[model samples]
Target: MNTPARSRITAVLPAHNEVGALPATIASLRAQTIPPDRIIVVSDRSTDHTVEIAEAFGVEAMETVDNAARKAGALNQALEILEPEGFVLIMDADTQIVPRFIERALQEFQDPDVGGVGAVFRADPPTGYLELCQYLEWARYAEQIERTGKTFVMSGTAALIRWQALKDVESRFGSIYDEQTITEDMRLTMTLRACGWQVRSPVECQSTTETMPNVPTLWRQRRRWYLGALQNITEMGWNRVTRRYIGQQVMLALSVILMTTLIGLTVASYAVNGFLGVQPFWLVIGAVFAAERVVTVWDQPWPRRLFAALVIPELIYALILQSAYVGAVWQKLNSSQGEWAHLGTPHKTTEEV
Candidate 1:
C-alpha cells in the first residue's frame, strides 16, 4: 500500500512599509515547527526596506504591479503567481505566530472539508490603556472562538487555507478574492462556506499582533474593519452560508441599540430625580455581567482580569466600538470608500521577540 503524500505549505505575507516589523515576522516564520516550504513576501509599493529585509532573510520576495487594492490585491498577485499543491498561509506583515502554530493549524486540515484555519490572536505587549483594552478584547474573542467552534472570519491577521478551496472559489467566482471589498478575509470566508467548505478557528493555533497605539489610529482601524464587514455581508447577500453572518450583524446592531437605550434612560432618570435612582435587580444583573467579563479574561494577566472585573472601563471600550459600528453604517449608507490606515511601525528601541 502506498502512503499518502504530505502537502507542501507556502506562506504569503502581504507588507506595505513594514521595515520595522518585517525582520521579526520573517524570523518567526523560520522558527515554525512545521515551517513553510516557501515564504513569499508580497510588497505593496513599500518605500522602506521591507523587500531588502525579506531578501536578507533568504526568502522569496516580490513586488505587486499597479496594485491599488491593498492587501487583497497583493494576495491576488501572489495567488496568480504560484500553483501550490497543498496549503497557502495568508498572514499580515505585523503578525507573529507561535513556533507550533503552523503545525497545529495544519492538523485541522486532516478533514478534507476544512477550508481554512484561523489564528487565536493576542496583542503584542500593550504600552497604553487603549492597547490594553484591545488586548483584553482579543482575549475575549479567542475565548469565544474556543467555546463556539465557529468562525466568522479566518482573520486576515493569519489564516491557513487549502489551495484546492481557493481554486474552487476562483472556478465559481472568477477570482480568488473580490478586490472590490475592503475585508477580503471576511468575503473569502463567506465565499468558501457558500461553496461547501468549512472554516475553523481552533484554540491551538495562536499568534501575536500589533495594536493601535493611539485613539485616532484605533478609530481608523476599527472603522475600516466594521465598514469592511458590513460591505462584505451586503455583497454576499442572503444564503445558507451568509444567513448566520447577517444574523450576527443584526444581533450586534440590536446590542448597540439596547446599550444606547439603557444609558439614555439612566441619564433621563437621573436628571428627573435630584438623587440617583438605583434598582437592586438591575445591579444584580450588572454584577453577573461583570463576572462573566472577568471569567472570559481570567487567563490574561491579573491587571487585565481586574480591569474586566471593574467593568466601567470595558463599558467605555464597548461604547467606542459601538460608535465605530455606527460610523461604518454611516459610511455604508453614503457609499463612502474606506481608507486603509497603515499603522506606524513600532519604535526601534523596543526589543524584538
Candidate 2:
C-alpha cells in the first residue's frame, strides 16, 4: 500500500485564547517546505483576539459549537467539518515546526500501514532555572526517542496522521478523538496501534514547543498528563496493547520509590557518620548516577552541561515529577477528574519558539 507523493495535507490547530502565540505558529506553518493544503484554527470559546489573529494571517478560523471537552472536542469539531481526504496534522497552537517538518513526516506515510509520524521536540530557550532544567529534560527525552524510533505516545505538540487512521478510529470508537480523556494524543496513538496502524517518531521530524514557566504550572500539567494516562489504560482494559503501557507506568513508579529510599538512607548514613566515614560502596554508586546525568546532557550548552554535572538540580526536577505522579495516582484511586482549565496560555511576546 502506497500513498501518493502529492497527497493533500491539512493542518488543524486547536486553540483557546492563544492570541500571543498564534502568529508565530501560523507563520511557521506557512513557511513549511510542504505547507498544508488547508490550515484551520479551531477556537474553543476563546474570549481574546484568537480568532482575529488567526484570520489576520489569512488562515481559516472558527469557534467550537458548545463544546466542553477542551482540546479534543475542538479537534473533533474541525475533523467533522473538514472531513479531510488526506493526511491531517494536529498540533498545539504554541508549537512551531521546522521548515521541513511536514516533508519529513510525510515520508513515513509512504508505507500504507503508517498511521502517524510524531515530532521530536526541544523546549524553547530558557528564561530561568526551571525553564533551563525543562530544556535539558526535553533534550534527554528527545535523545531516547531518537535512539528507539518508538515513542510511547505521538506528541500532541505536533504529529502528522493519515486520514484512513482517523476514519478507522471514528468508525470503531465513534469519534476521531476520545473527548473524555485529558491526554488525547496518547489515547489516539494507542487506538491506532491497537487497530494495526504503525505510529513512529523519527529523528528527522522535529518541532519546538513552550515549556511551563514555573513549578505549580508544571505540576498541574504533569499531574493531568499522568492521570489521563492511567485513566486511558484502565478504560482500554487489559489487552495486549495496554500491557506495555501498564508495565512502563509501574516501572516509573518503582524507580521513584527506589530513588526516594536511596536518598533517605543516604541522609541517615550521613547523620550517623562523618563525611569521610561513609561507606565506599555508596560513594561508587553516587559517582555512577552523577556520571549518567552528565552524559545524558553532554551535547547541550556548557551551562546546561554544568547543571547536569551538579546532579542535584535535575534530581529535584525528577522529584517534582514523581510527586506529581503520586498525586495523579491518588486522584485516580479516588475517582476524581482532572481539569482542562490550565490549557496553554499565550506567551507575553511573539518571539519564535
Candidate 3:
C-alpha cells in the first residue's frame, strides 16, 4: 500500500509595511505540518523591511508597485511570474497559523469539487478589552460556520484556493479578485459560487490573527469591510443569497433605528414626567444576554465565563460596530466608497484570501 501524494501548495502573503508582524507569519508558514511547496511574499511598495524579512526566511521575495488594485495586483503580479497550478493559500502578513493549519485546510481538497476553504480565526491571545469582545464574536461566528458548513466569504485572513476554480474566476472577470469591488473576499466567494464552485470554511481549520486593538481602529477596519460588502451586494444585483444577506443587514439597521428612537423618547418622557420607564426592560435584556453567553462559553475558564456574563462590554462593542454598517450604507449611497486598507494596515491593501 502506498500513501497518496499531497497536492502542491503555495502560500502567498501580500505585505505593506508589515516589518513588525512578518517574522511570526513567516515562521508559522515554515512550521506548517504539511508545509507549502513554496512561500511567496509580495512586497507591495513597503517602506519597511518586508522584503528583507522574506529574503531572510529564504522564500521568494518579490517587490511590486503602481498597484491601484493594491493587494490583488500584487498577487496577480506573482501569478504572472509563476504558472497558476496547484492550491494557493492566501494569508495576511500579520497572521500566524497553527502548526496543522495547512494540513487541515488541504484535506478539504479531497473532494475535488471544493473550490475554497476558509479558516476559523480566533484573535491571537487578544490584548485589551476591545479585542476580547472581538474574540468572543469570532467564536460565535466560528460556531455558526461549524454548524452550517458555509460562510459568506472565504476569509482573506487565511484561505486555500483551488487553482482551477481561481482560473474560472480569472477567465470571466480577468482577475481572481475583482479590483472594482472593495470587499474582494466576498466578491471572490460570490464569483466562485456563481461559477459553480463549492466553498466552505471548516471550523476545525484554525488560524490566529491580531484583532483590532482599539475602538477607532476597529471602527475604521469594519467600516471598510461593511462598505465593501454593500458595494458588492449592489454590484451582484439580485444574487439570491446576497439579497438575503442584504435583507438581514436592513433588519439590523431598522433595529438600530427603533432602539435609538425608543431611547430618545424614553429620555423625553422621563424629563417631562419625572419618572423612569423602560429601564427595567433594558436591564432584563442585558441580564438575559449575560446569562446566555456565560452558559454558552463551555469549557472556558471561570474568569472568561464571568467576562462572557458581563453584557456591558459586548453591548457597547455592538452599538459602535453596528453603526459602522450604517456609515457604510451612507458611503455606498454617496459613492464615497473608500480604499481597502485591510485590518488597519497603513496603506493600500485589497485581495481575496
Taking all chains together, each candidate's TM-score versus the true structure is: 0.95, 0.94, 0.90
The local lDDT score (0 to 100) that residue 54 gets in candidate 1 is 90
Q: Candidate 1 at residue 346, lDDT?
A: 49
Better of 2 and 3 by lDDT: 2
lDDT, model 1, position 158: 90
Which model, 1 or 3, shows the larger lDDT?
1
- Models sorted by lDDT, best on top: 2, 1, 3
Span of ten consecutive residues with least summed lDDT in model 1: 344-353
**Model 1 misplaced regions, further than 4 Å:** 1-5, 345-353
For lDDT, the strongest prediction is 2
Tens-place lDDT per residue, model 3, 259-306, is 688679989999999998557887887788788887666546677778
State candidate 3's TM-score: 0.90
**How far is each candidate from the true structure, as Cα RMSD in Å?**
3.0, 2.6, 3.5
Q: After superposition, how far is residue 34 of candidate 2 from its true place, in Å?
A: 0.6
Give model 2's clash tally.
0
True-vs-predicted CA distance for residue 256, candidate 3, Å: 2.0
